[model samples]
Target: MTPLVELSGAGFAYEDGPPVLRGVDLALREGRALALLGRNGSGKTTLMRLLSGGLRPASGVLSLDGVPVSYDRAGLTRLRTSVQLVVQDPDDQLFAASVEQDVSFGPMNLGLPREEVRARVEAALAALDITHLRDRPTHLLSFGQRKRAAIAGAVAMRPRVLILDEPTAGLDPDGQERLLDTLGVLSGTTVVMATHDVDLAVRWADDAAVLTPAGLRLGPAADLLCDPELLTAAGLRQAWSPAVTAFLRAHGLLAPGAPGPRTPQALTELLGGRPHP
Candidate 1:
């Protein structure tokens, strides 16, 4: 199948700074989640901006579906509707009074019918499991609640590809799990999220892509998360789970032997001989 989004040899730079991204190439296939991992100021956000058409690249090409993206009015609208970007900070995205209004803003801006917009707002809230906050003031919500609301707003757009920047930042343990579960349920959508939470990326993303001063590196989520040297070089740390380690040790696949399971199914296979809880 053709990729939902593609970036080829894309490069960008700010007014006075050196290039934020250099020769970056990415492809988001349907029904796959790609995690963009990097430290602060590593050009992750800049790449998102370029993909979303918020900022045009100084060179190279970015295409959604098959059409090249430009700064033209039609291209902007196409990019906006096809790829919805949830900003890192909820405060920047939530400007409406109520939670419902904030979530409805995107579809409303697209000139969708009032009923359609209402249905989308309701569905987005339900997907994020925040229907209870529909009437609450956005400013009064907790940090986690605000993050969910921000995501709901992006979901309201019904975009084919969703780009979330640092979705797990500033959340408590419960909140993080809840948000991960929310992301887990989004089927048939191409998701590219930039997160420093290595554990979250390991558990939630189908593949992990690291952003470094050198360039973008794509590989298995578990392998990338387990490598301390690679993580440190990219300004990241592993999110090692105890259960994963135990399973690997049981199968004699933890380092010294063969590589351990990088996915849940593999873990299950390795532990199939053990009695179930």
Candidate 2:
């Protein structure tokens, strides 16, 4: 399948400081959730910024849908239309006084007709389950509601790719679950969420891309996340799911031979007929 976005041999640095990302090659596919995993200073956010065209590569190439992305004003405008980024900090994205105003900003700026923009805003707010907040003051919203509003702002643009940085950072358990469920149902949009939460990454992403100082290593989420060595090399601790470990040991399927549980239901089914460990 043609990727929604691609980066080849791309590199970035800050004014001659040591390179944060180099020789990185990656492709974001359609309709799949990709988890960007790494420790601090491993360049995950740098890569995300590059993906969003917020930063251009110092070397190499980036393309969307097989066409190379140009950073010119017109091209960048088109890029932002197709690929929207939701910053981790809600305050960074939401500046309007009212929730409706904030969510309508993207589509409205895209030169959409007033009715179309209104419809998009209404749909976006519904998608994020923040419809009741339409007329509420942005400043009065809690952190979680603000995050949803920020996301709705991006969704109103109807982008093909949605990039979120640390989306679950301050969300409560219910908020996190609702957000994850919402991400799951966003038809035709490829979701790329950068998270340090290994467990969330493992359970949510279909494919995993790990970032180290050396570059990127991509694979099935199950394989990349369960490998302690790979996680350790990327300066992350192995996030072992108890259900996965118990099921694996019970079946004597460890490491190389095991495709452990990706969800709680799968874990339950695996141990359904077996005796307790």
Candidate 3:
């Protein structure tokens, strides 16, 4: 299947600066939740920017559904219509006075009719579970609400691919859980998030892409997160899932090949009926 988005041998660097990324390849399969994992300066944001038409590749090709993306205005419009990027900071994206206006900004800019823009704004607000905040002042929203507003702005664009940078950052545990729940409800949209949260990646992502000094490695989330050496090389700690799995195996609670739980609740359940060691 053709990737919804693909980068072929892509390499990028700031003007007059050393190469930040070199010879990178990535394919985003439709309908899959992918986690982009890397330490700071590993080119995760650069890769996301390349994918979302925010940056044109300096040395390679970026394609959408098998077609090379053009950097021209019309071409960028075509690309952004299918791909939307929500940056890490909500304040960076939220500028309008009200939530409704902010969310409507993208569709409004697309020359959509008023009714269409209103409809899109409402739908995006509902999708982010912030419909109640529609009329609220954007500046007054809580950090979590602002985050959702930022994402709602992108969702209003109705992109087939949603790229989020550090989606869970600055949220408390409950806020993070709610945001993850909202992400889960985005039924047909393919979600790509760049995050430093290894446990979230292991628990939620279907696929994982890790950037290492060597290059980018892409595979099933379970396969990638379970590899201690790979995580170490990528400058990430092993996620709790694999650590728990290993502990269970050593304790005779799980077979050598038995799959481990992904969440804290599941881990608690797995240890149920057994005395604490």
User: Which candidate comes out best when scored by lDDT?
Assistant: 3
The whole-model lDDT of each prediction reads 0.85, 0.88, 0.93
lDDT of 2 by residue, 88-204 (tens): 999999999999999998888888899999899988999999999999999999999999999999999999999999999999989999999989879999999999988898778
Q: Candidate 2: misplaced stretches above 4 Å?
A: 250-277
Backbone clashes, each candidate:
0, 0, 0
Query: What lDDT is reached at residue 6 by model 2?
Result: 93
Q: Against the hidden reference, what TM-scores do the models get?
A: 0.87, 0.91, 0.96
**Model 3 TM-score (2 dp):** 0.96
262 Cα displacement, candidate 3 (Å) = 2.1
lDDT of 3 at 37: 99
Per TM-score, what order, best first? 3, 2, 1
Better of 1 and 2 by lDDT: 2
Best by TM-score: 3
**Tens-digit lDDT track of model 1 for 1-277:** 6678888999998999888888888888888888999999999899999888888989889888877887789889988898989998999999999999999988999998899999999899999999999999999999999999999999989888999998888888888888888888888888988988787787788888898777888877766667777787898876666346755677666765555565555666766754345
Minimum summed lDDT over a 10-residue window in model 1 is located at 256-265
**What are the runs in model 3 whose C-alpha is more than 4 Å off?**
273-277
Per-residue error for 43 in candidate 2, Å, reads: 0.6
Ranking by lDDT: 3, 2, 1
Checking candidate 2 for backbone clashes, the offending pairs are none
Q: Give all candidate RMSDs, comma-separated.
A: 3.9, 3.3, 2.0
What is the Cα-based lDDT of residue 249 in candidate 3?
92
Error of 3 at 17 (Å): 1.3
